[model samples]
Target: MSHGPTPSDVAAVYLQQGPYAQGHDPHGHGHAEARGHGAGGPAPKRVIVGYGFWIFLLSDIVMFSGFFAAYAVLAHATAGGPTGRELFDLKRVGIETACLLASSFTCGLGYVAALQRKQLQTQFWMFVTGLLGLVFVILEVLEFYEMIVKGAGPGRSAFLSAFFALVGCHGLHVTIGGLWLATMMAQIWVKGFKPQIMRRLLCFNLFWHALDIIWVALFTIVYLLGAGA
Candidate 1:
């Protein structure tokens, strides 16, 4: 005969875990020890989402770290071609860096506004952040345009290739970040701080700040040191 749970057993399961629809735990883990129902899962949806997204961002950071390392090794080894010292413009880089850093700060304010449930403030600050990010990408593209026009394209030298790759990666990140910010603006209008919406917004915040940190490293290595070399 096949063994199966009886109606009384089902009742016992429900009694133990309450009516949260968290489903039956055959192991009888109980409500106090569940994974996401205010137990080991930790602070509800917001915290759990933040934790998961942070993990994703950390993995992305690792990928960027590899890119940075590769760039570092080849940034100055230009194979008898023009080196970073001959190509970089520190003033332009400084302007790009300032735009990016300011965007990050505005993003921070948007996160705070989101947490406070200030819809107007959140939307305004997010728009500001996106605008600043767009500006940064434009400046970076212009810089690249100048380099390419001056015969410093990635095909010209290993250093130039690494330089373009590292900075271009950052430029791509800002472009995507701008899209995400615009999506969030639409989301707040439609979803209005729902747990899932907030989850995504906070996740994007983590990602945006992580990009900023990578930019700092790039600025120091590619712009500051590269220019000096």
Candidate 2:
């Protein structure tokens, strides 16, 4: 004759039921651990890296926000010195903005090439992006030199100080980004789109895009508005 269900078999059936249908584990233990209420599983390395980088990016943005606030407060404090409308050159600013924006596009293309494992295309696009960034930086340097020669340097007044601090900070970031692109190109050449290298590339793309966004804000608030004022 067939035997009745044993105690262990009954316990298995209970566990097979929905989690909420049972108040606790059949073993008289809390269901928290089984229900993923305890420590989470170890995150993947990619996820960990991405999360850390996002925190870094957010902190960087906070710093920029502080700078923006300072610049806004001091934008009109020229103290009888050259104003933004008198000192700024819209034609050059337009060209610099164009180059930087174009570089962002090429940077995206390079990232796509990297994901496809196209080493040559990646290198080509990254090189183009770096060249464009370089051009933007050179234009910025020329603008600074022009201002300095015209007695409108950062030390000239509070307005100049804030303008230099804000614009110079962005220029510095672009310079770093160009260096990062070069490093990525070299790494891809030697390592061939390895997972870790791809992660770095992804981070670089985020960083470069962030710079683009910041530049847009700077252009709008500092350049366009300042010029109008």
Candidate 3:
């Protein structure tokens, strides 16, 4: 087999192509060398990040699927506690859902602001989005507290357990999202929305949008369908 370039030969190649094109195997590993020599055209770091994030999302989806199956299994085991039809207030849930949806929209606008380098506007919108998320979580917490106080706790029924399991997980995410937004806002004030911050924003966007998708399941599976049947 033609073993191609030694270090000296690769140095000649590097000299010919210049530093940008001649990918230095910073890892000093054979795979790095193979990548540079391979027909794959020297894969960029962004490609690695993209592929990694994709696997992360897929694993998250698998985890969520387990929750969904649990919910399905426990959907009808209301025990003696208040059932979905008896307990769910669609008008109120609708309001909370809309608030969360609107927060996601404002988050998108905030991303645009960061892209344009409008630091103040970006922080302002991020805070607004965070506040909306906070409001959503507060409402959910209020609902749960009121129910548990009235003895409709998760311990009262498998249905309630699954309900809290699915929807409460979403509420927890919203709370974390609020904190993340607040942190990002502070980082913007201190460091400005640089490329690294922009990457973070993209990751948060994925999280925010995933929350919205999960809420769709809560709305349909836990609320609309449950209430109807």
Per-prediction TM-score? 0.82, 0.83, 0.81
Kindly list the per-residue Cα lDDT of model 3 for residues 110-156, writing each as its tens digit: 98898999988898888889888988898899889988998988899
Candidate 1 — which residues are off by over 4 angstroms?
Answer: 1-43
Compute the lDDT for candidate 3.
Answer: 0.80
State how far residue 60 of model 1 sits from its true place (Å): 1.1
- Lowest summed-lDDT stretch of 10 residues in model 2? 32-41
At residue 3, what lDDT does model 3 achieve? 69
Clashing pairs in 3: none
Error of 2 at 149 (Å): 0.6
What is the overall TM-score of model 1 with all chains considered together? 0.82
User: What are the per-residue Cα lDDT tens digits for candidate 1 across 53-161?
Assistant: 8888888888888889889888767888877788788888888888888988999999899999999999999999998888888888898898899888999987788
Segments in model 3 whose C-alpha atoms lie over 4 Å from true places: 1-47
Per-residue alpha-carbon lDDT of model 2 for 39-103, expressed as tens digits? 44456688788888989999999999999999999999999998999988999999999998999
Task: Note the Cα lDDT for every prediction shown.
Answer: 0.83, 0.89, 0.80
Better of 1 and 3 by lDDT: 1
TM-score of 3: 0.81
